[model samples]
Target chain A: AQTVTQSQPEMSVQEAETVTLSCTYDTSENNYYLFWYKQPPSRQMILVIRQEAYKQQNATENRFSVNFQKAAKSFSLKISDSQLGDTAMYFCAFESFGNEKLTFGTGTRLTIIP
Target chain B: EPEVTQTPSHQVTQMGQEVILRCVPISNHLYFYWYRQILGQKVEFLVSFYNNEISEKSEIFDDQFSVERPDGSNFTLKIRSTKLEDSAMYFCASSDFDSGGPYNEQFFGPGTRLTVL
Candidate 1:
């Protein structure tokens, strides 16, 4: 069984600043994938970024990046130069190769203050 | 430009009524999935379909929940007896391949909001 945990329930950041959302997971599988998904007020689940366990390089999508520490079982999402559009409920997900199920963290409500 | 699509953006059904959520995965994708999110909870996987059969499912998908790919393109989730707890937003997603790669991104649809009373 795999599980994802997001310790932070809510976080706020001023526009143009940076914010980091923490996430941890328990998985015995060595090879897997980590993902960050954003759900705005519209309630649409949008993929933010994804990191492959085999690759040590953290995944980056513009202002969004991941700090993946495989040994620590930690994968955190960092949003730089945050904007109002970035305000949403962010969820951390875990999925392994050949596995379709995605175990998700509780989620972190992020608010970008002007 | 390809994307997954789900029908019945919003559904209001009485308790114990059967509700069917429909989805059309990306045309070229082989893997399909159904995920649900309660009002303030994280998205939970319900089931995954591949090769014309169920590859995996979560505990939440009990005997009352069933999935079918009746035809070649549409994937459906049928809840035999809806409960208040079943009211949530259901999302459909699909991936081109399961292998980890840049293109393995799962495209999601707008989702269907099921409201049970």
Candidate 2:
């Protein structure tokens, strides 16, 4: 079994500033995938980004990026030039190799104060 | 890009009654999944379906829960007897094996909010 943890229950940031959300995992599998998902007030969860365990290079998607430390079991999401729309509930997820089921963390509610 | 879709944005049902949530996964997708999130809780996996059968399911997916693809397009999750704990936002997702192999991504639907009273 695998577990994901998001220590910060909530976070706040100002517009145009950057905010990073932290996540850690406990997994025995060497090969797996990590992901960040954002759920807005509408309850629609959208994929923010994903990182492959085998690839040492962190995954980046436009203003969203990740700092993946495989050895340390840390994968943090960095939102650059954050906008008000970026305020939402962020979740960290883990998926093992060849597995489609995702295990999610409690979540971090992020607020972008204008 | 094609996306997964779920019907009935919200549903209000009575406890002990049956409720079936419908989903239409991406047309070309081979894998379909179900997950649920209680208010302020983490999203929990329910079940995964492929090849017209369930490939994997979590402990939460008990005998009361069942899944089916009655047609070529619609995939459904049926709860025989809804409990208060069954009240949650259910999400449907789909993915394929063609995008440079599996685990590329799973596109999620808007989700269905089930309220059991």
Candidate 3:
């Protein structure tokens, strides 16, 4: 069994500021994948970014990036130049290399103050 | 761009009644999945389907829950008897196996809010 943990329940950052959301997981499998998903007021699950365990290089998507620490089993998301639209519930997810199911963290409610 | 789509943005049903949530994944995608999120909780994976059969399922998916792909396009999740605890937002997701791997990025649908009273 695998479990993801997001210790922060809520966070707020001023518009244009940078913010980092922390995530950690407990898994016995060495090969897996990590993901960050955002859900806004509309209640839609949107994929923000993803990282594969085999790749040590972090994944970056425009304003979104991740700091993946394989040995520590930590994967955190960094939002640069945060906008009001970035305000949403962010979730950390884990998927084993060959498995189909994704185990998700509780989530961190992020608010971008304008 | 192609995306996964779910029908009936919201559904209101009574306890013990049956409810079917439908989704049309990307036409080229070969894998389909169903997940749920209780209010203020994390998203939970319920089941995954491929090649006309379920490839994986979580403990949360009990006999009360079932999934089917009756046609080439539509994938459905049927809850035989809804419980109050079943009230949650259900999401449909799909992904294709590329050279990268089967663990390719999964595209998610808007989700359907199911309210069991």
Which 10 consecutive positions of candidate 3 chain B have the poorest summed lDDT? B97-106
Worst 10 residues of 1 chain B by lDDT: B97-106
Among residues 3 or more apart in sequence or in different chains, the pairs in candidate 3 whose N, CA or C atoms overlap within 3 Å are none
Candidate 3 ranges with C-alpha deviation above 4 Å: B98-102
Scored against the true structure, residue A104 in model 2 reaches a CA lDDT of: 96
Model 1 ranges with Cα > 4 A deviation: B98-104
Candidate 2 regions off by >4 Å? B98-102
Tens digit of per-residue lDDT, candidate 2, span B21-84 = 9999999998999999999889999999999999999999999999999999999999999999
lDDT tens per residue, model 3, A5-89: 9999999999999999999999999899999999898876788999999999999999999999999999999999999999999
Error of 1 at A105 (Å): 0.7
TM-score of chain A, predicted model 3, versus the true chain A, to 2 decimals? 0.99
The model with the greatest TM-score is 2
Displacement of residue B95 (Cα, Å) in model 2 is 0.7
All DockQ scores: 0.57, 0.79, 0.78
